[model samples]
Target chain A: MPPFKDLFKGKQKYVTVKPTSIQTEQPDGLWTKCTQCGQLTYTRELAHNLLVCHKCGFHFKLSAAQRLAITLDEGSFVEFDSNLVSADPIEFPGYAAKLEKTRQATGLEEAVVTGQGTIGGYPVMIGVMDFSFIGASMGSVVGEKVARLFERATRQHVPVVMFCASGGARMQEGVLSLMQMAKTSAACARLSEAGVLYVSVLTNPTTAGVLASFASLGDIIIAEPGALVGFTGQRVIEETIRQKLPPGFQSAEFVLEHGMIDMIVERRDMKKTLASLLALHERRHEAG
Target chain B: MINLTLDFEKPLVELEKRIEELRNFSREKEIDLSEEIATLEKKAEMLRREIFDNLTPWQRVQIARHPRRPTTLDYIGLIFDDFIELHGDRVFRDDGAIVGGIASLGGRPVTVVGTQKGRDTKENLARNFGMPHPEGYRKALRLMKQAEKFHRPVVSFVDVVGAYPGVEAEERGQGQIIARNIEQISRLATCIVVVITGEGGSGGALAIGVGDRLLMLENAYFSVISPEGCAAILWKDGSRAQEAADVLKLTAPDMKRLGIVDEVLPEPLGAAHKDREGMARIIKDALIRSIDELSGIPPRRLVERRYVRLRRIGEFMIREAAQEGFAEAASAGGDVLRATGPAGPKGEAKR
Candidate 1:
């Protein structure tokens, strides 16, 4: 979730009902390449499969909205802070409006969405990020909200599940944003040590500042299919080393294989998987 | 002429084909096609599940890194109660790599330490990809010590490739910070349990690695060096990483057998990414067991046992082939060595 040159990321509303086979005497479907597997995958096919390469099993790019769909129960999700906004405390050129545009474009208040919901009939705390929202940056509000969420979850005695998608600290918010990582992580740490079930789902593009803080502090980590789950992208590493990346570098599978992730799952199974997992957490708690 | 781009319109593909055929049969301008569009909408329901049935590891990584994947802040929304975030490594500049605070874990006071990676370009630069600097490690040490002071056990989730290696990080004494953690964590009296919830790499991992019990997620990895780095070192080419991984024996199954780790928390077949709840439950159970085990022992014993266990890493391993000759000779009636000689047990040697 860096300055990903994407404009209409999450809020790219479709004029058509859904992105089905829509051809109007013109070809609007774009040609995309799967960087990991190095195969020619149609944008539509990759999109249909939730950014996973059917042939090579490489995970494609994703945003927060996509994650909510994959993890939450169908029709059970209620987005929070659709209107919360970020001000240009740094006054970086065009940053304020940029935040506005990003908010509108991603359909999110800031970068994160904290809510109360159920994955499989198990009421739990939920936090999802939208990388498109200024690269899913963490700022004061983001941190504050996270801290509040943890406190709330502990109060409810419900397990908390967080999907981590961050570029790290929010630079635009300056030091204030950076502080949020500590604050939020601290909140998570308390919940975890107390023996409350804290499940963290590491998602695509988790890196940098975020990786150093709460994102890395999950009790249980789960990943989605074919995500780029590293703090440093292959591009940066390649540039640093002045060499080409190896096959499957930085992909979720590579991370999983490297022991960076707990599990790799398809989007369809995320809900049921979470439910069963939550059930087990309760059992463990009882036994404990 | 299949449109791979048309995943949402499988029925449309057929309808469009029929429309084409009809047009071929009668080229009059009196056909309306809007009616057929409505009929093709039903299959979209099933397609949702159809596309996400089975995901691959690479795909799962993507999900794990999805910009939309939840963040720590989001978790705050869903987990924990009465959470308060404390600041400053209580040192120079506050390190962002490690986050710790006071919060209730199952309504009990506990301290937590975890790595944080950023989601975007600028943030990534700032956080250094969850790679802690000396201060981050120090801050974690500070918080953990505080927990120990309160007689509260510490919980840590490890996820990082290593400590930051930037020039600034080096100047800040990253090594010193991590070394201090090793010293402090080893002697701390309170129970300590660590979970390799994600990537556990390098000394950055070791900074929080000194604990009473270590649990790793099923697919999570713990290694001295990343496979890619190892490949680069051995083959002078990072591309041979897969071959290195095949030989590294760094996976949970291998590590568990090696006794380097205590337990491998089982993830759903594909991974914990699919089953967050299941993963959470496993961690909770593991945490309880780990705490119970650690708490059972006296504090002094806890410290000594952990130290001895770490020191005894290679105790279980021996060069069988190299020693086989000497062992066999002794077994075959060669003079037995010191303590237990050939007259005692077979293969007993003084050398």
Candidate 2:
């Protein structure tokens, strides 16, 4: 073969490719687009980076399965309550259809996946919420699973770890959704009374009813680097206050400054951070 | 206080006005009009019943938000003795939206906490329109904890439009504070009696709302989200609040039917605003009865009962039967399986 430089100089046929065309032409699942920065990344590379944006560091939302696969020790998770699904207590209009469609799309029985798992050799009763399933809103099934997780952890004297990602309570279930806050909180109280450790990890867009319940009741609350964590939505706050919010209002960094969370851990270091914290608590418990 | 009136109450108000006018005319003319007045009075009573007896959920919502409705302070003034108002969360400023204190209910010492709304513009501003912040919940939590230590039962009156949706509220960790209150209140050694006096709005109300016995006024509404909010989200039109209200199942009777509330105390004709003292008297009796019943249970049992009561509030179904049913339905080319009544052997959905 001729020299590469010589070939390029002799027959320079430049084909200009537009970035938008490149994005559109690629197969759908091959590239993951960063929601915050609009940066295109190879899907496999992004997955390898724990779904954090390679360029902008935006933490993409994860499904409960993905969360379990990354956070738990390989093949260590034994799922719990995979059979529980929602019932329309009030017979909300169109709710059944919506639930059916969401279940079909996500293949999740409910918004939350609860299980007993080993995270870096420390066994924990864990529950991870998938926001894709109805915004991971705490309805009847979600509440029961979480309450059972805490109850089981209390009984077993095992530490519990929960990954919370929700918009709020499910509106379709009406006040039944609201009562889940109390249900989950009561379970959390029992866990605390039993003196079993509970660590809550908040992911992107944790707000409203879930935040006001067990998600906020964690003994040690950890947040992803850029998670939107707060009691109310930003638009609702702006409408109520009749003013613009300052930059970084409900971001993880802002919440840290306000002393709401224990720490902000990046996705890359989340497993290590969680393992260390669990080890510390275990050591302390043994010493005590 | 501004005399706010609902559209449905217009005919009742006009009838009352006519009755007053007739009395004035009889006095002015010095004529015997007793027979005519009695007939008119009977007509008015019928009209009142016809109007108030069949109130729609939307109408009750209006009553719950009525400016002239009895407030927390009004109930406190009428129902309790020696109501000394407590102040502050000690972590932050005292929230005027929520008021808490120690008082005697039928001669028994109890802790009282409530979300307070104001009668006028300035007072409403001071009260933040009864929407609490983190500090408000913290203050309620502090008082409840005190109640636990002192062995006094806790009585919380819920009448809020939800926690304040504001920046400072979030910055101060509103969610965490509310969560802490619910957790702490659930395990408080003292009995808790929460009354939904007016608008029991979402987690704001539930922050201090978990208790052994929950009583609600006939016209009061306890909702997950406001009708307006629900309407706006579901139908994309806030004006469809009436439909949302009808669907929310938030009225006292609805809650009672759902097994969420222990009792639905009747309101006076024309709702609580018409006879504040009468409404307070009704609530007083309910509180005394609830406190007495809850007080009989030991502290540990009280906590356990609370846990069980709360644990039973959700509705869901098991997937094994559902999946099997789905398989059958799919094979038969029929509809998806529907839950009959939250049936499961695990007792997770026991009513």
Candidate 3:
């Protein structure tokens, strides 16, 4: 009764039921897929590893709070400029709404969180950038906060450590964003003049205005492994040169090869590495 | 003799052409048409004023990018004397994109550094289309530091599309070099003046842009990113650059209003490209005035004032509840954070 094709189709429908285990959903926030190696990892394990992929060593971006938590001594952080927020300086379209939504979603007043904390028992002033909040762009508020951090550090004669992770100047703030480059750089100049040890740590994706300002002015510039650190973005460079970029272009390894950074440190070793550097530059007061 | 004509400048060009035609016609025919010629000349003058006086931000951007626009070299030749060309960053080969040396302004020795643009195709290639590399910025920093050492006022002229965005530029540490320049120049221990002569594009322009006084030419623009770059990033269309320029607030008046630039020097009737020498003379005068004004302050105070000027540049807000506590703490810290006060006199930041 069946033609050759119809006979095969009827036979294939005999076992259509699927297994229930594959269809059941796992609890949310329990697992994270590796962006580099495509490996499913327990979120708790990932956090314990400081958000670095255990399988492929991909250093995931960290929020300001998360960065502060892992880098500082337990319960030693005191935040500054927590009430500062951005204003629509240029009145760029949708900027206010974007800032509002980002503030709510990230629960942050600005992209960079300035504070005081001890690293490996060495007291230091610190500023950590949260890339999730608008690429940690250096808008007016970000600039003011960074400048204040350096100023405070300079006055207190404390070593300053900064975790720079930005996509450059915020476009919505217009030229005000551009001036932040000068503003922050001026502060770095003051810090250097005061002989304060400024350690700038470049995390994943530090480029453009931020890179060309305080991020690059560090006394010892250290970058995390596999971080994209450069003045220009890859897409912009590709378009300008009209060619595909080689793999690892603008990565921390590439930058180290080019002699831009002092060293490349892994996420887990960052705290110990920074503590030693701060200890080496620790100020000693003469006994009266 | 401008080789490039922009869309907005077309009407003024047409009016001037009509006036020229009338003059030629009268001379050729040996007719008494002086009155008609005079009338056309008056109309052309008014049209020129009308076009230049009320230029839109996008129009100013066009003028800034005009190929015939006067270059830094041209201004140096016209305004300064005894200009000895300097070269090389010592670590790298001399970059043609930036030109710098010691020169005399009105018999006062000053160090001059400027981003150079070429006049023609071959020159543009050599100049890398006015885009500096790491070496160029390094050379600039070297020259500026020398100026500081010699107690010479550093006068820098800026006109660049951006820092070069090529693979080689990236590999050579363009970002670090620029960062070094900005930091070193900020507390340079000498009076410094910066003039934005044309398109000041992003961090590239800012590599040599910080100073005690920032002066912008009438049609020149200074932006964090180029309008085309912003448009492509935000609108996903590079052609929407005109719209982006409007929103960037990059015009000279915008800079003045924002308290970023100290002064906006007026240009010739048809912009700098139309009257290069006149524009140079105006810039020369402004440079003299700025340098004189800045030279009066001692070096330490100059650096401190420079710090304060830069410190007060940004705009931000404080929540109403946090304002009082912030004000008291910031006042104790000093005037650096006084700009953070809510409803301050600058009125830059609002609740």
In order of DockQ, best first, we have: 2, 3, 1
Off by over 4 Å in 1: A1-48, A81-83, A232-245, A283-288, B1-351
True-vs-predicted CA distance for residue A52, candidate 1, Å: 3.2
Q: For residues B1-351, write the lDDT of model 2, one tens digit per residue.
A: 566878988887888898899899999999889898899899999999998889999999999999988899999999999999999999879999999999999999999999999888999999999999999999999999999999999999999988888888888988998899898888899899999999989989999899999999999999988888887777667789999999889999999998999999999987898899899999999999988888988999999898899999988888674333221222221011111110011100000
TM-score of the A chain in candidate 2?
Answer: 0.89
TM-score (chain B only), all candidates: 0.69, 0.90, 0.90
Clashing pairs in 2: none
Q: Tens digits of per-residue lDDT for model 3 on B235-296?
A: 66778899989988999999999999999999999899889999999999999999989898
lDDT per residue as tens, model 1, B35-66? 55345434433443443443332232233333
Instruction: Report the number of backbone clashes for model 3.
Output: 0
CA error at residue A285 for candidate 3, angstroms: 4.0
Task: Summarize candidate 1's per-residue lDDT along A1-288 as a digit string, tens digits.
Answer: 112322113311122122335434326544345555456555555566655667776554454445555556555655444334455553434456766676555445667777766676788878876666666767656766666678788777778888877655554443344334435554665576567888877766665556655666666778776565554434434545577666555556776775555888776567787888898877442553
Rank the models by TM-score, top first. 3, 2, 1
The lDDT per prediction is 0.58, 0.83, 0.83
**Candidate 2 lDDT tens digits, A143-248:** 9999999999998999999999777888889889999999999999889888889999999768789998999999999999888888877667766778988877
Chain A vs. true chain A, TM-score per model, equals 0.78, 0.89, 0.90
